[model samples]
Target chain A: MGQVLAPGVTAPDFTLHVTPDQTLSLSDLRGRPAILAFYPADWSPVCGDQMAVYNQVLPEFREHDAEVVGISVDSAWCHQAFAETRHLHFPLLADFEPKGAIARQYGAYRDGEGVCERALFVVDRDGIIFWSYRSPIAVNPGADGILDALDRLEKQENSDGRAQSAGNGG
Target chain B: MAELKVPVTAADHARGGANGQVVLVEYGDYECPYCRLAHVQVMQLGRHFGDDLTYVFRHFPLTEIHPFAEPAAEAAEFAGAQGRFWDMHDAIYAHQEQLSLLFLMGAARALGLSERTLEVALEAHTYAPKVAQDFRGGIRSGVNGTPTFFINGHRHDGPFDYQHLADAIQSVRSGL
Candidate 1:
């Protein structure tokens, strides 16, 4: 229910902790399409269900050459516990140092609530935001939209490649 | 808002007429308690609608929470291989609380399935890919939770209680 970071903009880049010792930057994931799942908090009911659904569909995401990363205001320690408890295979980056700094960059931070809104962003291989959605905090917004965007991205890339080949021949 | 991305095909485990007036597709997890409750409602719906409704069940196992979910789904798929998918499906929900490897084998036995065959299938994970396929289809169809239903290719966004689902079916039927 908030203004999402619109498509076609260069997605704001950030580095965040995935584990106590490991950190990942958005720029590092630019060569492949990536899905950023911004959620309110770790260990909440809807958040748990949302992440679990993504975990189950990781293979499908991979087929489209996409990698998923969950971002939240929770600390790295909290994320580690929740990720382990849920058996999440994807990295859950903590936006905790400045507390919602990365989320604020994407307009996903709920200022007064002290949490991030439930949102999703699909960043293309070139780091441009391809699609984004802000869902109600209580709803587990399913993976359909992300997959649709990825499908479109794949088709567009195919056409672009064909056009480039035609240009070369000309 | 969500539509069924993949149409039901011969590979799906379905009941009732192939050309039935209404099709009800459920994305269910065998280990989910809500899915167990919905199972009874689904059965009632089948009885109430009879030949007018085609019921299809697909796997959406929350394996992280319910460790046995994937295995239970695999058991059902193995039963499907022997042409007893519904029987295994029914047995699993009926004995929902007793979902263990041994219990699944017992259910297979009760359905007159070869216990040896099921054992081999489970150990070999012969049906895991089929369960994974169902899960992927459910994700593509916008299934966010257990017991998600789609009637006539549209996601049922309301509660899945008997009354609500019955009315939903009626509405779709009347539209047709």
Candidate 2:
């Protein structure tokens, strides 16, 4: 839970009701890599900018075969409004009632602020966590930062898979 | 030979004392909206209680996120030094978004301070240490983020409305 979602640990899956999109569960996204961008609140200036950045760079995410999703403690209604206002192409999942229950499960909840800090998680095709970064509540861990890390994980995994195949052939 | 261990004094902190009453200690950044929201409640509580409660504002700037927060906090402290702390505090909250030196100086002018003097104070980096001290104090007291408050030393662990905060303060008063 402390900074290492490690390479092999299976991600804990939950079905969160998202908006302007549909409900999503980690299990439903199996057989494909995905990125979860956990932000503090929707409609917040910084958060709006973060999602907009993701929308602009969505093509880059598609090239990596990854679906990017944003989660927050805001209600579905708020997410809908925020998505419409910001023109975000990605789904913004509502984690409102429990107030950071999932964020705490992911070790992104900050005790002091009573809100989920900004965090990013990359899950592999096998549903194992590949990369993660959680910024302190106030600062944003920009989408580009996550993309860079995701790129690294993808390259590393591909090279390892190729090496394993060569060994098997040998 | 004995190692000298100095005890921290209450005078060292404007908020700490054994009043046995619930004191709402708010560790906030000037630029934080949540802090601004909670500040309004703090002011309201003053009207509701009428001298029965104390609210202490501690500075904890998330400098990495809000680049101007620390500077704003320092300016507030400089204003506080001239007995205009609360006025400047309110002004900052009132003008949270446009947190520029020029805006702060305008606040100083509105508060009847010499603009030149306040500008020099801001440029001197005068109150940064005090604001930084508040952040260190918050960390030592288990504050990991902004808008953290302690109701009679028990942390307010969730989003709170005015009623909830009033109730907590009442509980502390009864216990005292």
Candidate 3:
């Protein structure tokens, strides 16, 4: 398993292909909280089940303006097939070419495995990592942890907003 | 293991086997295939452990993917209003392959629930708050997906298949 980042780190930036022709960058998610789901592979049992769970809960995430993106070392073409099979609405970014490059920056790439650890990172609107978790390789770490992080993020923002208003005597 | 944050109360739908030695709480979605399978297994467990088990179900509908789930849950609540909660629940899971508003209405009618009243409740989402409460409780209890189980107020991370669950229930039952 790779390293799991702690909260408050500046989430590393990268652009990865979502489809053969379309790519998404970390900057694309600047205005909203982004959930970076780094998993080992597309079709592996646990990964597939985990992604499907996220697919089912995507709306709940969007209710908080959090966009979920899956990352893996698979090629974009492979991602295309896998996303199709799963009917996933979110984009799965392929950390290809320099395989596991982005995952490595997040300390989520498994050494010599050529795959990602079952890692999760929640990045705030300012690109600061809000929370992260690395789960066991075989277990399908469900969306609960990600959702909890998002909820915490929302709570923090709300309280900060209240504090700012209080400072302004509003 | 995560423990159940909310204890079972009269607000919940519960059924018991003989001695009530174990409590199995399932956070389930009506549209989830795994939950449908677990429904059957839970029923089987009901037969096997008769008086020793008390099974409880709560809604955790993944509405984004399973749009019909929330509506189906509402219908179940509608039936619950008439004291036919378990009947409606079993009916919906029995026809799990065909879950929809129309199917739910049909099931409601078959169970002697007024179709128009069910429609009104569905449109108004009368039970959504209750379902959402169950959902929040599940989230707080570390439920990640449909068919998540809590055995005697503790999270059961192991497989919920018949034998595994039987062993789990047996262990919990024996502990009492």
Candidate 4:
């Protein structure tokens, strides 16, 4: 089994069908850092609340020049329903048919049950995973965590330095 | 934006099995100790209720912290392919710490899957997509955490041990 992709590893590029549109791809966000928040399911209490937190912090994400993308094993139709219900501003990709392929590739899919774990990966413009975190199924990670990582990434970018010593993860 | 009742695919029907009056859907994370504890309770419920109950397992593995969870899930899928899903499920919970690659292969071996075959199946990721599909289904149903159970499509509002599940099952079955 492929291990979880770690910091500085090249993120596997993908083009999943997302709600509000299906033409989006990770590459589309080139020249900017991106936040890939992979949650287990939609409409669940903690996941729903987490999305709302991300939505509330949209301004911070924009300020950091990082496009936020949420992913799940849900179908496009399901993604649409979830995005609408939560009023999410970002694209929620549906990895429906194959289930957790994207999540598995990113090393986030749990094997015992067929679902993506609550995982986060922050990738730089070149698709390098700069920071990563995975909250337990019982814990809902907040936007503050992502924002903190973004802040560190920005510092590294501003300094034009390697993330190794800069501490990309919070 | 409305949640649609998509028709069940052949795979879904096959995996969901024959349902009784009470269908229990559990959204769980393999790495979670709590979920593992819940796993025992779920099995107990299944045993106690027998023909009147059905259990559906869904994944919600937390990737960051638990490094071995995703692979453990893959192992379960490997067993599922050979028609030993429940056996594999119990094995995983019983040996959560031993779910690393080496240990998973050992578990498969104990379950009678040949080592070579287990290696090939796990490497091929034969059941990876199916695992993800379960996660998507849970998400569609609005599940965010592990061990979140529902009875007969109605969310069960408790810790979900034998008594709670038994009562819920009886309520649903009696009504039916």
Candidate 5:
């Protein structure tokens, strides 16, 4: 297992292909919080179900205004087929051309397996990582931690918004 | 690795492993195809372990994907009230392709359990809370999908094939 990027660090930015033609950078979703789900493969038993669970809970993530994006080392074509098979609504970024480069930047790449570790990052509205978790390769680290981290991020945002408003009033 | 947040108790439906040296808990869904395969694997493993392995099954339905899962879990729980949990659990998985509200009702009847009791409970959503509690507990234990296993309290972070699971069990038991 690789040493994962921890909370309080700025999330490393990369623009990966969402499909053959389109690319999405981390900063593209700068203002709203995002849940970066870095998994091992496409259509594998664990990763498929993990992403499906996230797809199922998209509404809950939306309640906190967080966008969920899947990152893996599979090719864009492979991801497209997987997304179609799984009926995935979210974008699956291909860390393919460079082969786990983005995953390596996030410290989620497994040098031994040539795939990303099952990892998660909850980046706050300002692009600072509010929380991060790395699960064992075999376990599907569910959406609970992501939701909890987003909850805390929302509460902090609420309090910070109030403080800013109060300061402006004065 | 995540630990089994809820300890095995009388409330859980356990089989075959009395005074067992190892405890294997599975968070499962009736509608999951993989779980059907896991069901058979567990049976074999139980026979192998006998008194050394106690197998406990918990409900962690992926309700969004498998809409029948929660209700099936509730039916299993209702049957559990009559000491027929394992019966209903097996009957439901016996025909994984035939899972639905209609299938559950028929399975209950085929097993010679009460339809009225199950209907009333399903209507009232009586066992839904218990199912939800199990689901929440699974999330707490880092269970993202069905057929997750915890061997002797620690999550089994390996493939869920028969041989791999058997090896994992052997290793865990020897460590004990």
Candidate 6:
């Protein structure tokens, strides 16, 4: 297992291919919360189930103004096939050129495994990581943690805004 | 570390005693081979524990991989409408190798369900929302894969072999 990026640190920004002709940049989605799910590979048993679960709960994620993206060492072509087969609505970013480069920036890359560990990072609207978790290689590490973190972030933002307005009045 | 967020309720399709000492909940997909294997073990556990265990089954179909899963879950739910959910569930798993729409219709016929009603239900997806509800409930309960089990509301991270599960249940009973 790999160490997760600590909360409160600015998330490393990267642009990765989503399809043969499309790409997604981490920084571009900064105004809204983002969830980065790093997995070992495409088509594997555990990875397929994990991603499918996320696909099912997309509405819950969107309720908190969060966009979910999956990253792996697979190529764009591979991702396209997998996404089509699974009917996955989220973009699957390919870290294929350097193989696990984006995963490494998030501390999710494994040195000798040639793949990324099953990791999750929740970045707040400000691009700072609000929570992170590294699950056991075979476990799916369900979405509860991500939802809890997003809920906390929403509460934090509301409180911060209230304090700011109160200070101004004073 | 995942715990069952939603406890088994009156709305759930369950077997065994309602006030049993141990409640075993399985989030399963009808089309997954591993879930088939776990199905046998679950049956064994039920027989071994008898009245002491209350077993609940929930839908967690990996519809992308197991193409027949979602429809199969709906078939079971449709049967639930007739108060024969367990019969449909057992038939589906028992005939796991033949999970086609035709086979599902035949299973419903064998279980004394109206074939026309089942066909209409399947075509119109009458029970799809119910299955979707179960899937969402499974996600909320931290289910990431098929055949995931929760013994007394705590996620069972161990293997689903008979002895492992039986021992876990025993330990939980002793703790209580």
RMSD of 3: 3.2
Return the TM-score for candidate 6, rounded to 2 decimals.
0.88
Off by over 4 Å in 2: A1-170, B1-20
In terms of lDDT, which candidate is stronger, 1 or 2?
A: 1
Ranking by DockQ: 1, 6, 5, 3, 4, 2
| Winning candidate number (DockQ) | 1
Candidate number with the higher lDDT (5 or 6): 6
Candidate 2's residue-wise lDDT over B19-132, tens digit each? 424566777888877788888887888778755765677887766456678878887887888887878888999888888878888888898988888778768877778886
Each candidate structure's TM-score, on Cα atoms with residue i matched to residue i, is: 0.87, 0.50, 0.85, 0.50, 0.80, 0.88
Lowest lDDT 10-residue stretch of candidate 1 chain A: A161-170
lDDT of 5 at A80: 98
2 or 6, greater by lDDT: 6
Structure candidate 2, residue pairs in collision: none
lDDT of 3 by residue, B65-121 (tens): 587999998889889989999999999999998998999989988987799999988
Off by over 4 Å in 1: A162-170, B16-20, B47-51
Q: Model 2: share of native contacts present?
A: 0.00
lDDT of 3 by residue, A1-170 (tens): 53688898999999999999999999999879999999999887557767877886777899888999999999999999998877899999999979888998999989877789989999998899999988777655777688788888888887667322344222
lDDT of 2: 0.71
lDDT of 5 by residue, B115-150 (tens): 887899999999888888887677667677778899
Instruction: Evaluate model 1: give its TM-score.
Output: 0.87
Q: On a 0 to 100 scale, what is the lDDT of residue B10 in model 1?
A: 88
Model 4: CA > 4 A from native? A1-170, B1-17
Give the candidate number with the greatest lDDT. Answer: 1
State the lDDT of candidate 5 residue by residue for A1-170, as single tens digits.
Answer: 65899899999999999999999999999988999999999988778889987876787788788899999999999999998877788999999988999999999999988999999999987889899999878778888788778878877777667322344221
TM-score of chain B in each prediction: 0.97, 0.85, 0.97, 0.83, 0.97, 0.97
User: Which is the better candidate, 2 or 6, if ranked by TM-score?
Assistant: 6
Residue-level lDDT tens digits of model 4 in A63-136: 88889988888888888988876567888888676778889889998888788888888999788999988876
Listed models, DockQ each: 0.62, 0.03, 0.32, 0.04, 0.43, 0.52
